[model samples]
Target: MDYRFSEQGGVTHVTLTGQLNFAANEDFQAIVERIAKIRGGKVVFDLATLTHIDSVGLGLLYIAHEELAAVGSSLSLLHPRDTVLRMLQLTEASETFDIIS
Candidate 1:
């Protein structure tokens, strides 16, 4: 997986593309650390270009959510592709996140 970080209207946006799986763990952890510095801030994951995700990817999202919440920050998943969205929903992880279409 690959990601780009940008800022708009006081929100930090991370645009993800390619595939998200165990291979992305290291990179995703770096992202989490970066966002964790923003206390009480809003961070959005723009997943519109992300083509695929696996259980490991979902677990990473969950970990990110918890880390951000603990730091008083918010995390949102935006425009997830159909396949990725289904994975989230089927796993019942959607309810734990703020997802935006």
Candidate 2:
């Protein structure tokens, strides 16, 4: 997936726009490094355009969550599509992360 990062009022939001799967690990790491360097307390994922977020993607998100939390930061998902929602429900992944409606 592709992501664009922006900051405002001390919040750094990374908006993802595309499918998040195995092909996107490099992109994920890049985003993570940028956010961590800035020490943003709130790491928001704007999934309004995310067509699908796969298991690998979920794993990456979990890693990101833990990393952020270690530094007193947090992660949140926003505007997930129906398919992604269903997967999260079935896998109980929603309960594990900060899934915002």
Candidate 3:
């Protein structure tokens, strides 16, 4: 998957495109670091351009969630595609994250 990072009004945003799978782990981790550095430590993952996600991708998202939570921060998923949204719901991952429509 491809991701772009930006910050606005104290919140960090990671805009994801393409498919989130095993190959995205390293890049995603780095993006998390950038997000963590933002003053409020609040992150939003924009998934509107994302097309698909596998188990590994879900794991990475969970990792990000736990990391931010541990630091007293938060992570939210934004505008996930139908397929990705279904996967999160099917795996019960949706409940673990804050999903924004």
lDDT of each candidate versus the true structure: 0.94, 0.82, 0.87
**Once model 2 is optimally superposed onto the true structure by TM-score, how far is the C-alpha of residue 32 displaced, in angstroms?**
1.0
Ranking by TM-score: 1, 3, 2
lDDT per residue as tens, model 3, 1-101: 88888878887888999988989888888977766665447889999999999999999999988878877789999999999999988998767999987
**Clash-forming residue pairs, model 2:** none
Q: In terms of lDDT, which candidate is strongest? A: 1
Candidate achieving higher lDDT, 1 or 3: 1
Clashing pairs in 1: none
C-alpha-based local distance difference test score of model 2: 0.82
lDDT of 2 at 29: 82
The total number of steric clashes, by the backbone 3 Å criterion, in model 1 comes to 0
Off by over 4 Å in 1: none
Weakest 10 consecutive residues of candidate 1 by summed lDDT = 92-101
For residue 30, model 3's alpha carbon misses the true position, in angstroms, by 0.9
TM-score of each: 0.97, 0.90, 0.91
- Against the true structure, candidate 1 reaches a TM-score of 0.97
